[model samples]
Target: MKILIGNRNYSSWSLRPWLVLRHFEIPFEDEVLMLSGSGWREALQRRSPTGKVPVLIDGELAVAETIAIIEYLAEKFPDRAIWPRDQGDRALARSAAAEMHAGFSTLRSRAPMNLRASHPGKVDLDAVAGDLHRVETLWGSLLEKSGGPYLFGAFSAADAMFAPVATRLRTYELPVSDRVAGYVEAIYALPAFQDWLAKALQEPWVVDDDEIDVIQGRVAPGTLA
Candidate 1:
């Protein structure tokens, strides 16, 4: 099995499957495709039918989309326990991941994933604020129901689904209360998250389009530096 991913720093979609595989201890070869300039576009077109990162290729089968890839992995490695065991918890987890997959366009657009960059207390968009509020509510409710640490107690597909959002909230310093802060801390403390960030910090490829300048705790209109 082989997994094709994008840049470690900016490709949130790529992080999903990568984290899932790592969390479950699934042995797979990783192929990192740096998404800089037209190279990413051409590479993705050739590598995946959907031209997206996080494609899982198992011999002849090529899987695209983060959720699909995760579901496939869960089925393929049932012993790894990727999803919740309880039926009710599994339903909620799937719903949470699906909601994350479908919604949060505003937040995603304004704060694209750049795991290595930290912009302290710099939230300025109302749409993004609303999305963050929803996320906090979701996280708090899940923590309350599951009892500490991950959203579903043990790491599930849900955690892999929301890991990028956690990184976004932390990097941008978005408004989060104690509960949300604790949850984010747990996510950052995960071994997989630590591994991914360490690899990302070592990479030298930087995209100018992804970087933003800040003034007085707000992103200023400037090209990537």
Candidate 2:
């Protein structure tokens, strides 16, 4: 399979399926498109019906959207254990992934994912408190049940769906409990995640749009250079 993605540095949507593919050692080709600038839309349109990044193109089928791509992969590689084996865990995992997929707009808008931006302290988190609580409650219960380094006992699609949230929490330095912070650390420490982060640090592109606080002169640029 070939996955067309935006830059590893800024595209959280692109990161999901890419991480899953890499984590499971599924051999796949990837093409990165600049998330900004002229012609990028045309480039995306060519590969995906929805004209979105993170489109997975198999032999004859094309999958758009992160969740759809993940579901497709799960079906294609059933033995890979992309989701949990236990029916209850599988249902909960799907629900968690779905929640991450469709909900959390408040947090998403206030804390845009910027791999190269530094927000040293909390900002606009109050506006997103409800959403934050939802995340924490969902995660806390799951972790308590699974006794996990991941949301589930294993790193499933739910983790992949929420991977960008971990980066957002880190980038903004949001005040989370020790449990949530530990979860973030575990996600960051994953070899797949670290590989993505290293590439993000080295990439030349800086998404001016995602640099929310920096553009507003609220926080300084967090670029490595």
Candidate 3:
């Protein structure tokens, strides 16, 4: 199997399913396509049915969307605990993952995921206050119930879905409870996440749209190094 991804520093969507594959010791290769510039769009059009990155290609089957890719992986590898093993816990995990997929627009827009950069105070707290509260509540409740270093006790697809959010909270220095902070640290400490972070820091390409400095007008476009 192969996963086509975008720039490591900026592609949160790509990181989700990739983490699952790596964390579960699944065998796969990955190819990086620049998120912008020179045939990137054309490449995506050719390879992806939806013209998006993080498409999973397994023989003739191509899976688009992060949630779909993860669900596919779980179905393909029944032995692996891709989600919580208990039926109730599995339902809760899936609900949270789906919420992540469809919600948190303000936080996501204001603080795009950029693993290599930190821009505290750049994001307007007022804009994302509600979203942050939701994050704290959701994560805190789940962590308390699961007694977790992760949302479902062990790192699962739900954590993979929120991994980028953890990065966003830290990168923007957003206010969160100690519980949420601990969960964020747990995400960073995952060996699979650490591997991804190492590659992300080394990436030469930058996606201007995802850079908070550029978005906030503090840094001129195309000026990032």
Candidate 1 whole-model C-alpha lDDT, 0 to 1: 0.86
lDDT of candidate 3 over 149-177, digit per residue (tens): 99989999999999999999989899999
Question: Can you give the lDDT of residue 151 in candidate 2?
Answer: 88
- Across 125-214, the per-residue lDDT of candidate 1 in tens digits comes to 676878988998898999999997999999888999999898888889888889988888998999998999999988877765556443
lDDT of 2 by residue, 1-225 (tens): 899988887898999999999998899998887876678778777767998788898989888899999999999999999999899999999999988889999888778887877876656767888987987899899999999899888898899999999998999898888888889999998999998888888888766667775656766766423
Q: Candidate 3: lDDT of 25?
A: 95
The Cα local distance difference test for each model comes to 0.86, 0.86, 0.94
Q: Give the runs in model 3 whose Cα sits over 4 Å from its true position.
A: none
TM-score, structure 3 vs. true: 0.98
Q: Using alpha carbons, what is the TM-score of model 1?
A: 0.92
- Estimate the Cα RMSD of every predicted model relative to the unseen true structure: 2.6, 2.5, 0.8
Runs of candidate 2 with Cα error greater than 4 angstroms are 214-225
Best by TM-score: 3
TM-score of each: 0.92, 0.93, 0.98
Tell how far residue 218 is off in model 3, in angstroms. Answer: 2.1
